[model samples]
Target chain A: MSETAAPLAAPLFDRVAIVGVGLIGSSLARALTHYGVARQVVCADRSPEHCAKAMELGIVERATTDLAEALEGADLVVLATPVGAFAEVGEQLGPLLRPGMIVTDVGSVKQAVLRDVGPHIPDGVHLIPGHPVAGTEHSGPEAGFATLFQGRWCIVTPPPGANEGAVDKVVTMWRRIGSTVELMDANHHDRVLAITSHLPHLIAYTIVGTASDLEDDTKSEVIKFSAGGFRDFTRIAASDPVMWRDVFLNNREAVLEILQRFTEDLTALQRAIRWGEGEQLQDHFTKTRAIRRGIIDAKQA
Target chain B: MSETAAPLAAPLFDRVAIVGVGLIGSSLARALTHYGVARQVVCADRSPEHCAKAMELGIVERATTDLAEALEGADLVVLATPVGAFAEVGEQLGPLLRPGMIVTDVGSVKQAVLRDVGPHIPDGVHLIPGHPVAGTEHSGPEAGFATLFQGRWCIVTPPPGANEGAVDKVVTMWRRIGSTVELMDANHHDRVLAITSHLPHLIAYTIVGTASDLEDDTKSEVIKFSAGGFRDFTRIAASDPVMWRDVFLNNREAVLEILQRFTEDLTALQRAIRWGEGEQLQDHFTKTRAIRRGIIDAKQA
Candidate 1:
């Protein structure tokens, strides 16, 4: 059935406060408006320029630097800032939240969200941490689009014994915004993301780093010839610096764990090459090809 | 000046033979026809179906399975087959080559080409090994297009003491086909490609393999959630299996050398992650970002 065929119930929340007006935050605001998922959308950004631009773009009904002012009269509040700022934002919003209100976030790292944002969510104020598992290399308010979440996965991790209604409402909101919602524990979410996103970003950044360190002439040639394999790494490395910094800081455990495994595998492959073990190299390559096929069969490729 | 501004003084060869009508071979055939670089383009492939399709698609003037027959009367012969088959094809074509004939190839690994085919080249024949650093994920005759080489580098590694005129003519042909030509020793070309191309492919294949070994449910989720990072690996892994196998087999030395460096770097990153070395991770990531910027500045990103 078409997504819009869902019963046209009254807007889920009276006012939705989006705390941050960057790419992910702004995209959420746009999708919420496009789907009429909330009665009103207000935004809070540390950057006054971003707040002004978001308001000018008409993505949110109101934009402000005052977090409490934006949260006033809002039934749903989304902490859309970088993970590094979540604890402070959570503490600031905690005092202002009413009994029936719900709090959540769209951060890349989930366990850190629970640890940082959970304490500030007062009793009877439900908290559902979520990650939409989607984005482009671009950032900022202007980079967001209404369909940013379309056909993507939105993972929600509500603490045990938390309000089911609150989780369902958040899931429904993501569905309205054209996302498939999956419920996962926050720790599991961190591990999965470490492999699927964090490690990839790290490797891309490293290879690009290696290239950057080359001498001027060689470096220029590296870029000129980047279309071979390096271009893809460049795209991944182009992601928002502050946001990624926060991700690494928050999800330290899982990212590190998977990174260890990746390193071991990489080392083994290296030895095979150094030792001129053609069979080992070919065997590994052949095995990897099967994984690619699996991904294609799953419609991911 | 427009590429078509200059007309050829005369045809370089009466008939140009291309053995193996895959993406690269068929593409060369198309470019030869489009630019009138050759008098007639003849193709041969081990797959009868490919030969038939090449003829049906009009990618070449004639298609055949008999390598010796295809080499007849051809002043220029291009070995478009995988690197693994070069020795066999070289031996067959060596005796049939008339004086003043030029034999070149479109292979990824240059040193291997010299090792396998250099000895077979008769005294009067010229052997210029070229690699056009361009391709899509697709393969086979039907996947060929004339513009594949446009704005791409085509490295020509002519053996030392080889005919300078022959090298010039091969370079001219590549330039006319819309490729930027660079001359380097075959060994150096192999080393550069090992870092830029071969090692990246190996890593991609390995990571995808690791994902494939995950539990069934996790594997499915991986594919579903692949867009975040895994999609790029899938594209690389989907490349022609036989061609890649041949590449690994032929360029064993250089590919192995670079693979070692990549592994060492990967291991260091892994240890940092396992030990929660956030600063080290951040430093590496920051360094990599500079490379990405370099690529962009060079217009390769």
Candidate 2:
């Protein structure tokens, strides 16, 4: 069924407040307005420059540095700031929230959303934590495009006993904005992303750091010859540092668990290379090829 | 200076033989013909199916499994096979080679080319190891395209006292095919590529394998939500397994050295994440971002 089959006259949310105008937040605002899901979009960002850029881009009807002003008269409030700032933002937002308002988020780590922001939610408010599994290495309001979420997955991990109507509304909004929505447990979401997202970013950052520390002559050569494979890691490593810092800190246990497995796997391959075990290296390399094919077949590649 | 400004009317070689009708070989063959660089192109492959595909695609004038037959009347012979097979292939071709023929290769590792194939070169024959730093995740002759090397670097590592005339001819041929050529020491080339290319591939293969070995239910979710960062690694891991297997095996010392540094760096980041040291994580991530900017400014991004 088409989630956007609603008539053109209908606006899913009369007033939607986006409480961070960075890449994900700006992109969400653009998508919501482009899909006619929100009659009015207001964004709050700590950076005055980002707020002004969002306004100039016309992604929202209003932009401000005041979190309370942005939340005024908004039935849907999205906490799109970095996860590290969620607890403080939650404290400031609690007094501004009204009964029946729905609160959601775009943090990478899901469980942290509940731990940081859940207590501040009003008794009658609905809390549904979400993660839009899509982005480029680029960040900021200008880096965001309206089509960033197209054909991507948006995972929603609503807290237990979340109002069904609020969850359905959020799902419909995401679907209308061109994401396939998946409902998952918060802890399970963290585990899966630890492998799929967090671990990969960690590896990319490490390798890029290694390259940067090379002798000056060798460093230039690395950049010139990077098209071989290093360039891909550089792009991943270019992702927003503050956001990733928060992700690693908030999802420490899962990320560390996966990192340990990755380190062990890497050590075995290292040993294979050290011992001239061509068959072992080839066998492991060959097995990984099938996973790539699976991802391509799933339209995720 | 503009490399391709040379008039297209001049053919760089009378006849060229490309050993191994795979992605790199076929693309070089197509570029030779597309730019009128070779009067005739011949290809040799162990796979009859690939030979047939090369012939049907018109990328080569002749295709055969017999290396000697393919090299007949060819002034330029390019060994484009996996590095592990070079010693045997070199032994076979050494008897068939005539004096003054320029033998170049597109191997990822340079020192290995000299070690495995150096002794096989006949007196007066030129052996210049060339690595064109470009490729997609795809492989095989059908995956080859004429524009693969355009604007990419082709590093040529020639042995001491190599014939200057032969080196100039090979450099001119690569230029005609739209590559910026750089001359470097073979040992240095291996070390640079070890960090820029080999280590990244090793890391990618390990991470992809880690994700693949997860519990089946979580594995599917990892693939489904991979756009976050893992998808990029999967693309790199999807690269030809046999080709990469030989790379790690042939360039063992350099690859291991770089891998050691990478492991230490990763462990540092892992510790920071485990201890919730957001500043340390943020600082390292912030430093890596500069390398990406350098790649972009260099037009390699």
- Tens digits of per-residue lDDT, candidate 2, A1-301, equal 2355345637789999999989999999998888888999999999999999998999999999999899989999999898999999999999999999999999999999999999998889999999999888889999988888888889999988888999998998888888889999999999999988899899999999999999999999899888888998999999999999999999999999998899899999999999999999889988998999999999877
- The local distance difference test score of each candidate is 0.81, 0.91
DockQ agreement of candidate 2 with the native complex: 0.82
Q: What is the lDDT of residue B299 in candidate 1?
A: 74
Model 2 spans > 4 angstroms off: A1-9, B1-8
> What docking class should model 1 receive?
medium
**Candidate 1 share of real interface contacts:** 0.52
lDDT of candidate 2 at residue A188, scale 0 to 100: 99
Native-vs-model 2 lDDT?
Answer: 0.91
Tens-place lDDT digits, model 1, residues B1-301: 1243247445555789999999999999998877778889999898999999999999888899998888888888999998888999888877888889899999999988888898898888999889999988778999999999988899999988989988988888888888988898888777677666776676677667666666777777777778888778767866776677678777777776556556567667667656656677667766666776766787776
Q: Where does candidate 2 chain B have its weakest 10-residue lDDT segment?
A: B1-10
Judge the docking of candidate 2 as incorrect, acceptable, medium or high: high
